[model samples]
Target: MPISRLSDLSDRALAPRLVIKVGSALLVGKEGARRRWLTALVAEIAEARARGQDVIVVSSGAIALGAATLGLEKGGRGSLADAQAAAAVGQIALSGLWAELLGSHGLTAAQMLLTLDDLEDRRRYLNVTATLTRLLDAGAVPVINENDSVATQEIRFGDNDRLAARVAQAAQASAVLLLSDIDGLYDRHPKEPGAQMIPVVEGVTREVHAMASTESNSGMGSGGMVSKLQAAEIAELAGICLVIGNGQHERPVARIIGEGIGTLFLPRRSASARKAWLGGRLRLKGSIHVDAGAAVALRRGSSLLAKGVTGVEGHFDRGDPVAIVDAEARVVAHGLSEYHAGECAAIRGLHSSEQAEVLGYSPRSSVVHRDQLVLK
Candidate 1:
């Protein structure tokens, strides 16, 4: 991918659906919820739906609203317990607001609060994906937010930018529009002299990351430019285009689609939802190293077998994400392991016919099925 101008989303049949991320700052301010802006935003969403586009909103105002109601605030953050309590309180208010606004346009709202595990664990990830597809089928716009009430640091996404990207991948959205306070990433901080906004980012490079990371979020928002870039990576892996733009304008989304008033990140594209998930997610528990023959087999779309296994490194249970590396330590692919690390270790280099005797039970023949693997 190379940097270029934002394409006309309307003029192109780019994707069947879209995921829009609304930051906490965009949704709430010093006084209260920014209902007027939200109303306009959803109106555009309704307009998109009118054009036969499925839309999902990954919003981030629960903690801000909840914190204000409870009178405990650290720019919309508090102790984990307090934040959780605030989310429990604010989510109801948030849902009610979404209901009223979307209903006014004859659109229904469905609330979904998810934590990292919801997208990290394969089974739960599939469930979330199915539910999202069903919600769209029912003509309801799903308003999603991170499950702050029960999530700990250990399993949290830490920012909605990445969360929104994950949602886009899960929903197989055509594109993602991240509504940020600033118009888009600049050559430098917008404050410095001669700072010009970069309209399109072909890819997130190390230099690009350092350029925007100096800036910080305001009010209750948590994500800054760096997180948005992180989101960009996820979008690229999913082969979904992403845009970061200022949402503080009238019919902001419309202008973004019509005039391209932001930075657009292009993508390479995904083969399927399953491959996207397997390739895009960040957490990997361990690695399975194989010989050159195994690597060739995998490239030819063969499932990983015990006969090719050399060794296993790291602690992982079945269904965990593990890197499949060749003898030279180059990662050739990523996959969900059929057997636990221990089971895999025990059956290494053994024939399928002899595996049951070693393990004392019948196991799946393939260590990593072709369907579960995504080549790098």
Candidate 2:
């Protein structure tokens, strides 16, 4: 069902694991950090935690804050080196502020700086997920930011909007809240005379994407309506609801959940269906060929063990999705490999007990764990 009005958001739907993306424009100002806005936002987060909802914040402002601190200008004129230096300096300030603000509310905050490699590499992806889960379990809010200090333009996500959507998927979040300069998506640019606010978007159709303005509204932020729409599409594919609203208001988080003052993008699939969709979208990076007995074991719901006598067929990194083929060369399943191709080549046909001795260290016994595998 589409949510065309504020009344459509119920308390039951509101209480879920939420990933909130805060833009640089809302969090930074001329002098420095916007303390008043952050204080209120932290209070809202604390209130949500009290209501038994786990919240993760994906924030953007390190570059802006750093640039402000160094008296450097914002925008395209800044060099890559300048941006990196600024991020290094600004991240400390950003994390420190979050810690202090949340501390006052009796909540602990954990800082996590991530690069694209962290999510794309299988081992690092699992590690990150585990760490975030542990932090949430321990009643701490995770404050995440892109590792801009080390990331190059070629590998960077560029905007936190897409990063937040990926984080929501990784954390298995039920909802995502994007706090932007504007209140919600509009049928046309809100500045236009006849533009209309769209309260609910069932899906990100081409029409919805076309509604986004080409130019960003905030000079401090990199993402515009187009990026938010892209994020909404990603969230929708993950079966996670996304809300885009104005962060300039007092108690913005509270208003979003309580009053539903935003454009809500409804999820089109269930969690299981979403997973299946993801499996389908992955391009096969490699293929692992298994013997008949191993194929039968796989069909019987066993994890793909190294002893299964697999032949690695391509160069791929750990966490890259690969096809699993039987003796007949028929593709039977697809999954994220626990080890890279070279590691698999060294340990193939080895017993679980011998994995540590062969590899010098055993990260895991299964080459492809059942949880990561999807049967055809």
Candidate 3:
């Protein structure tokens, strides 16, 4: 219980499941070339697998790789589209390196590109979880990245750190390892004269935020200390521990796992699996109207019954996203509807058992099952 430093925290005592995020700054250096750091990082992951650990890597390097390939890499501000094009070019090169390196270690690597919406919609969220789980079960490592090619300004995760945190929550990992160019957070910028290293942090209090800086290190990546903290907040709320460390060190992943060479973040109370899936994975498309009594029932941990639904307002299908609201029109929860708009209209005020008689064919017992309903 006397945790003094990150290295003191035993890997055996920690969560066995993990989500590791490597930033672009660590993947490539300022000269617009691949860094030796990635070789060591992949070695660490292979070693972790040797010890029977489940690992999912959320990595950022496509844009950096793309820029290097084109020989037009520069350290300057550019348009979002320019960066996106770099990502498109880099993703191919990045995957090639990942596949080759991981394959050498006798491990298979699968590439997964995701955006914010994948984790926001209930159905798609479940699908993603299922795919990741299957890959893990088959003893293959999944390398995840943001779908920068098609992702618009509004839907992008903004940075891979935040995307990693969401992926950690979705996979219900025990911990999230954020590897970057910097070794750890500092009391001030590492370049500052009086800057001191504070090793272990418990929560996102004012003291923690004070350590964050907005300085960017890589032209290929957009995150800084601020974005890392934002990602940590999300992972912490999901009961996923995080460690921010330098990727330049040889076997950095192994050092963090066995030797603990990073700034460790403790987790808060863990969210339920269903709630985690709902919060981390599902995307909402529309809203449904409910009575005041139904809202109260939902808040009190009850299923969304037919008597509670006042009206269906969305142009969604049976499995389309919809929100459950109260008489005052406040959103109570979000879930996929069992009945479509026309079907819901036909049995708006009917009881659960009467759904079959009214619709002539019941898709599900509850209009929205408790499993599908996520409380706001």
Candidate 4:
């Protein structure tokens, strides 16, 4: 395909759900969190939220901020120990800033720290997705970062770019905007004379990979241009549009989409790789007790329908993780509950057709979807 122009985007529409990745290089400065930029970015996000669009931010900078707080060199992960300490110190400040910034726009911010293990483990990935769904349902913006303090090369994602892609896959988002210092992919080292910018990429080829600069332009960030391409590949496989854009502007997302000031990687026309039997671990808040017949049904990989539940234990709200136990109160499985403890109690043993009358709302047929359950 030929290069796309800004005029081509005039009549275009963006995806309903968008995931934005903000690298540490763009978010942190000598003073710590760049409030001015963050304020600008969050303001735009608040506006999008107001317009009824869902947005999730995958951010980096905890370790950088922690290093700054500890008076260490900026972005200096001199040793594994040093990086972990910096992340521990920085996460507190990062979370606080995220809360304060989004709160100004009357938006609640929830923090999620993840590692590669969180995404790869069959039991934990589901929990993360469920939590994200819950937060979005509550109209809160989730600020996610790698759990750097506890992350090691063996378990860590290593960079936010690819993590953002994983998040988009789990969220089933339509678009991913990778905000960076540079505008987008280029034909050669941008500094080289006559180097040209590529406006749109339909595929990732060896030729495309060769275009990536070997060195990270931003000395502070772990993700270089290469990682952005890697992220694009992931997004493409999931049928999610990925854009690499300069985020220094007031409303970078708008500029990227509207002005064509970024490189847009088109997703495959058909995306089937996005679907998989995902696993995850989430904080457990309650338990659901079921009859022996229901236990047998669940053991056969059936969903926990409302009619099977004998009782609910503890006080878990919607989207909270709960144990599914048998008559002996032995845990059969762990899964996210579709309804709150009260709701589950109110509808226990009731058929799906009978739930709306008792609950005053149409209830999910299954208290726990089979896909969300992990058999013990």
Task: Find the candidate with the highest TM-score and give its number.
Answer: 1
lDDT of 3 by residue, 38-59 (tens): 7777887887787677889998
lDDT of 4 by residue, 1-376 (tens): 3214433322214466778999887889877788888888898788778777788999999999999989776465988888999999999999999999999989999999998878766567778888998998999899999999999876777889989988887887767789988999999999999998998898667699999985667688888889898788767666677888998777777788767788888864434431322212223588999999999998897999999899889999887778889998777877778988998999999999999999998887689998777665
Winner on TM-score between 1 and 3 is: 1
Please list the C-alpha lDDT of all candidates, in the order they appear.
0.86, 0.81, 0.75, 0.81
Clashing pairs in 3: 66-90, 119-281, 120-281, 120-282, 120-283, 121-282, 121-283, 122-282
The full ranking of all candidates by TM-score, starting with the best, is: 1, 2, 3, 4
TM-score of each: 0.80, 0.72, 0.71, 0.70
**Distance from true position, residue 119, model 3, in Å?**
1.3
Model 4 is weakest, by summed lDDT over 10 consecutive residues, at: 273-282
After superposition, candidate 2 runs with Cα above 4 Å error: 1-14, 75-77, 271-376
Look at candidate 2 and give me any clashing residue pairs.
none
Mark the regions of model 1 whose C-alpha exceeds 4 Å error after superposition.
1-7, 287-314, 323-333, 337-372
lDDT of 2 at 47: 78
